[model samples]
Target chain A: MDNFEQFFTENRLKLDVEPLPEGFNNQMIANFRAVRRKKQTIRLFAAAGFLLLLVPGIMLLQPFFKPEPVALQESPSSAELSILTRLQPYQTEIESSTQFISQQRVPTEYSVQFQDFLIQLQIIDRQQDIYQKQIDSYGYTEDMIQQIMYNYELKLMVLQKLQTEILKINKLSKTTNHEYTNIQLEI
Target chain B: MLGNRQDAEDVLQDAMIQAYTNLKSLKSVESFGPWMKRIVINQCLHFIRGRLNFADLQLVNTPGESDETDYYQFSMEELNSTIQQLPDGCRIVFNLYLLENYSHKEVAEMLGISESTSKSQYQRARQLLQHQLKKKMNHG
Candidate 1:
């Protein structure tokens, strides 16, 4: 190299690479964590809000979920009431699982498909309720109790299937749009 | 270019944050070093542009400046201090073109100035540095 180039090269070599300011890396990591926490808080509030809207709607629609008491001549036995109480936990699980599935971010094309899946789950829930009402009316026979439990399992399975489908779609989208990989890394 | 260590640090921090946020958009990991340097340079330019009006960069005329022989007489420390004293526009063009090995065209594109402007700024920087170095040598 000529003296002009050599002069610059010597100067460049002499220039020191400055050390990062004290606590800078820690500060940066903290900022990133704070941003991530804010996003999680927002998501939590949204999920809570959705549950708030859903619970009251379900309560208002209680009549549709039950057969009229006048239709049954005999009062339900303790055994039938116990069966109803046992099913409550499964019902709560299904509701929360459905909520989780609906909260996922999906493409526009899959939204209609997701809606269809939800409708199918609702149909299954109504079927379970119908079988539950039959147990109250005809007395809790072994066969009737088994049918109700079967429908409960079916609802849970459908919810699990929907969750799996949502996860698959999320993975596919992340692969296609490379920027989404950063979000996944943050999570 | 930023003239002080504090301003340089601040710009570095901001550039690092931006780079981390957009890291996933980078296609190859091998390009990370150059990518980050570009981000830092851009941040420094942005900070300078925001604080200093371009129209205020007074064009200096230093006719009969000392020849290249004066630069050979000075120590590296003297050369460095003289570079640090250059005006912002001249300093930036000098650093990018000479030290950083960026072509005038690339420096112009990076700084959003015309190619001719980059060349003139570089020439002006060299002239000023040569003059300052000669003065220091004569005094010392």
Candidate 2:
């Protein structure tokens, strides 16, 4: 124990360290102050982001301010139904279609086919209006008459042609469900 | 050997500034001293990198002026030079264990090394420093 104490004493005595010059503490204080300033900046940015998240709710009803869920509730209609609330997907498709049509420098045969498909769809819509009017006028008694007058065979043929043209247009757009899947796979 | 006190002060100040700026990214605040020391050491090493050779170490032979001289005690200059002479890993372990008084387990956690490795490095540093002191005494 004495030997150990002597060794410790010698070690302590031999330990050499110079005092930092005067104002060293001041430098450290300055550094700590700078650190505080940086922390404040980060806090400010985080506060800004947090406030920005509240912007959408500023005009909303007070009920929306309820606390977030603590535990997960099992439900089948969790997220997918959100697509139906806003016409987001359809609006996006319309915007993309308009952009594609407007941005093309050269008009191609595909554009003509697309225009024809639209015209054909308009015609079918008109025919459906006429059929609806006839059905209403005849009441329940003229079912056979209404069916014969509309010519179901010709109408079916036109409907099948419309379906085929719509499929062609979907293919030309390069934006079908299959293409969406492929793009998702690539991503 | 870094010219003068002003230059050392400048380097040390810059190193402190860098450590302060990057303090948030430092996961462990308990080991802040060694972390700051590391930055300062690196700056000092960089300042004297290419200029150092075996002959430069010979200047460390400044003899004790008296038997009871404080020069035998831990002079910052001598301590700094002794630390500078240590290998990178050994120097870090030495400072952590000696000045900071960190246990091998704590040093291991701080350095992301095994506890045994920290213990072994600490032992190696002690042995190496003893060897260096013996050599200095014999030469002097």
Candidate 3:
């Protein structure tokens, strides 16, 4: 036999090569079962951890689905009152303008000039009121109200200038020989 | 010998655990030692990958610790332990050829090594054993 073969056989003889210890097979089987059990335990823990991660997500979605009742606290302040007061003038102007247009064009679905001016004015007033209330009812300070009012006033001035320009055009067209070529009244 | 025996033992224990853990995926029952050996080797490599500078690894000899004991005089247990003491690659080749009766080609295929490598390892193992046997005879 080759030296490797001889040595290997000799070494093989030296080895007890017994089938493990008495009950060793049973022990190994038990160990294998324990290892499997451990893996299962780890998997269970992983699943539980994943479920735990979803808890906040589920809570966030619950608010979107069946929302909890939010109690609105009433705490209207001077800023809110001032905002309503500022909007009152624009609201009166629109109402008066619409009334005038309704009287002038009795049975019209909508007087375009009146509707345009009133809607624009109302939108500006609504924006100002929203800011005012955010400051007052939301416990915003006087300084914040002044800041929002300043912005709203600048916007109102620009709209008023635009309205005046429209009025000038209307007057010049009526007095002069030139008629408004594009003034197609659907009503 | 490379590190603390406790550390090596721990690594071996871990490798055994890993082997058992992944036992279900193991298709062949007979390939358990090789699988365990792979894990042990990987663990060892991981422990000393960049840290160990293997300059003379090719020249390094398999452990020939003692020059005692004739072949037949040694008990089966002694022989098995000595075989186990062989370097990782040589021990594997020895087991496959001697105990399992695997051909060199089969061993090479199984280990993903060249046929020449398997043959050479087997030859080296034979020479080492012959030397040990001769020493034992001279001493007696």
Candidate 4:
């Protein structure tokens, strides 16, 4: 070792490091506990504050989402009123045809198809109502009102054609059964 | 070498608190002693740097009275007292290099100074400590 290194080594050998202050370890552990407790308290407060904000936030948003009951007898827009008036003449005829078709004895295989067509009519009626409401509330263009009228006329034509086909099938089945009874009498 | 025992104890305590708080970040548990020692050294340096400005370190003159021959005859207590009297920068370098057994390169890195500066500061501290010890020995 060099002179300075040797000298430092000798000095280090002779040097005495004082023992840590009495009860230092216990004091440190106590300090650590206090610090930990403080941190946990801070975290608890933060969680409490978050929950306080969250509960009121959810409550405040509930009313905006609660479904309101829509009132009946609200006057339709003038365009929709005119369209309904134009369709008034066909209303009785369409209703009678629908009742007759419902009363007819359809084949079990055709029952599901007939029910599906009725459902389609109901869906179209609902869609037309929604479009009418949109036009009234949003000041939709005349072209939009015309489109709704055209769609309603098309649905009426489809129902009329379905009623005619069902009536023809019923008449054919009645004739076929009557002819079969006559042949049995002859045999 | 941190001026007094009270200051040294305070730094040690603060370093311990810091070490405990950040213990989870330590990668090697076996190096805990050296890691804590580094923290203590850093705290001591921070205290010294706060007490004495960088300009003051440059202004401190190297003691001219003593040579290496004077250090061998002194008692450990005398040597310690003499070390404490060194200027802040020199004493820090001396303590880190001699007592802490850090290399000059490590001392330079720790102090954020050039290696040559660490070397010169250490030499100055040794010379001043020897000079102070010589005076005490002659008087006693």
Candidate 5:
């Protein structure tokens, strides 16, 4: 753009170069190392963060990792004997009700409801088994016996409610009232 | 704008530290030279603006001759000696537009000056450098 720029261009290499301060290069090397160390520290922290997060993640997935079920005693021991005897009738009733509900060719809507109740009943059965193991391990209290009896009764109640609802729905819906009326669920 | 060798050295060191810290953000190794030059320019601008208000510089009429990107490029040592001879506003505009190949608009934004102010200050810088160089050529 100007003769002055031509002079600058011609003398570019000849132009005095600014000398870096004494020890400046070495100081920069030291800083680079420090920065590298800091980056590594940040990476380590991130890894530690991920591992800590996995602790809760694994805990949340704990139900899927249930331990192998322990086999029940061949014969009931004296400690659990009294409670098991009291629970037998309700247990038989629950088994028969479950089979009857499953065999029923109910419409899909009531079938979905029955399946939900059945899953709940299975969860109660598992709970009762847990209390029985506790009785075996630490001996039974009246509380343990009462809880097992309560679980069985709850299952029967669920089955009865389902049966009553289906019967009521069959009566109200004109499609085929006599078809559902012919079937009776054993409590 | 940062007068004196001690201050210049300090800026250089600080600029090196800044570039080193953000090296990971640099996209290419080959561009390190220009990228570093840009950083140093920014640091110098920051150093100058900290003490001097850029808005205070007076603008003039008529724009200066615009130089090409590679035309006025020079070494930092040459710039250090050359630009310091200029006043605050002209020194920064000259350094950015001439030595570093920045456009007048870029210089304006960097210095918080109007584009017209950048151009005029550059014109003044061009006039001053021409006078100074001619004096040196004839006298020295």
Candidate 6:
């Protein structure tokens, strides 16, 4: 060991910890408490924020999230107007996507599935037209709006199912055509 | 390793707070001293990481006397104050290696420096400390 190392080792016990500043203990305690309190306040705020979001989210989605349909007897209300306003976009979306489907070429003849999709679409369309006439006559009762939204949603679902089937058939047709090309090349 | 007195005290207090909160995770009470030291040292290392530039410590010459009594006359407080006055890089390397008994490898890994750099800084520390002590001795 060097002279300094030797010196330090010899004086190790005599080497004092730095003399504490004035009121060091009191300062430590106060700072510790402040830090802990700050942490708890932050945690409380986080939980409060989460609950604040959750309650309104549940309220706004409550109607759509209902497992069983509510009986359509409520009088026309602002809430119904808001729901109808929100649903207007969905109505446009369904109509446009439905139109887009006719523009797409049918990749295969899934006769039974295609027939079922057509039948369901026709029935929902007929029901929606009836609801529209009733709303026109009665000035949009809550029940009429709900029925119209329900018909639109059902039609969108059937169209989505038919579109998925068509996509699957398209993929199968592409793979089969590739195999046929390989066979022709070999021959 | 933070040169400022108040900053060092603040780091020490934060380390204490960390140790107090995580005390339950300690496996044994006997190991508390080293564990607490680890916390404080970690806090200090974190504080100095942004400040210490390892590239600046070019060791000029080796330090030490053949006689083991060269610094025997100096008080521990005097030695400590001199150490405190050291440049941030070597002071930290010295504290970790000599005082804390960390291996050169461990010191390097802890300080995010190469082992050779750790050794060079340490040698620089020794040279600087010896220079200061020699000045003190001549004055006294």
Q: Write the per-residue lDDT of candidate 5 for residues B6-48, one digit (tens) a residue.
A: 8888998999889887878767655655777788878888888
Error of 1 at B129 (Å): 0.9
Which runs in model 3 stand beyond 4 Å of their true positions?
A1-20, A45-63, A66-187, B1-11, B27-70, B77-92, B99-102, B109-113
lDDT of 5 by residue, A115-155 (tens): 67657767877898898787666555666667777887887
* TM-scores of all predicted structures: 0.50, 0.33, 0.40, 0.47, 0.47, 0.47
TM-score of chain A of each: 0.45, 0.25, 0.32, 0.40, 0.44, 0.48
Q: How many residue pairs of model 6 clash at the backbone?
A: 0
For candidate 4, write residues A132-168 as lDDT tens digits.
6865555444566566667667677767776776666
Per residue, candidate 2 scores C-alpha lDDT tens digits across A37-127 of 9889999999999888777567474455533332224642543244233334443554454444434332243444445545654575577
Clash-forming residue pairs, model 5: none
Output the number of the DockQ-best candidate: 3
The value of fnat for model 5 is 0.13
lDDT against the true structure, each candidate? 0.72, 0.53, 0.57, 0.68, 0.68, 0.72
TM-score, candidate 5, chain B alone: 0.75
Sorted on DockQ, best first, the list reads 3, 4, 6, 1, 5, 2
Whole-model lDDT, model 3: 0.57
- Which residue pairs does candidate 3 place in steric collision? A3-B126, A4-B126, A13-B76, A14-B75, A14-B76, A14-B77, A14-B79, A15-B76, A15-B77, A15-B80
TM-score of predicted structure 2:
0.33
Each candidate: RMSD: 21.3, 24.0, 15.3, 12.5, 13.4, 17.3
True-structure lDDT of candidate 5 = 0.68
TM-score of 3: 0.40
Error of 5 at A117 (Å): 44
**Looking at model 4 chain A, which ten-residue stretch has the lowest summed lDDT?**
A178-187
Better of 3 and 4 by lDDT: 4
Clash number for each model: 0, 3, 10, 0, 0, 0
Candidate 3 residues A144-187, lDDT tens each?
54656565565556455545645555565567674345432221
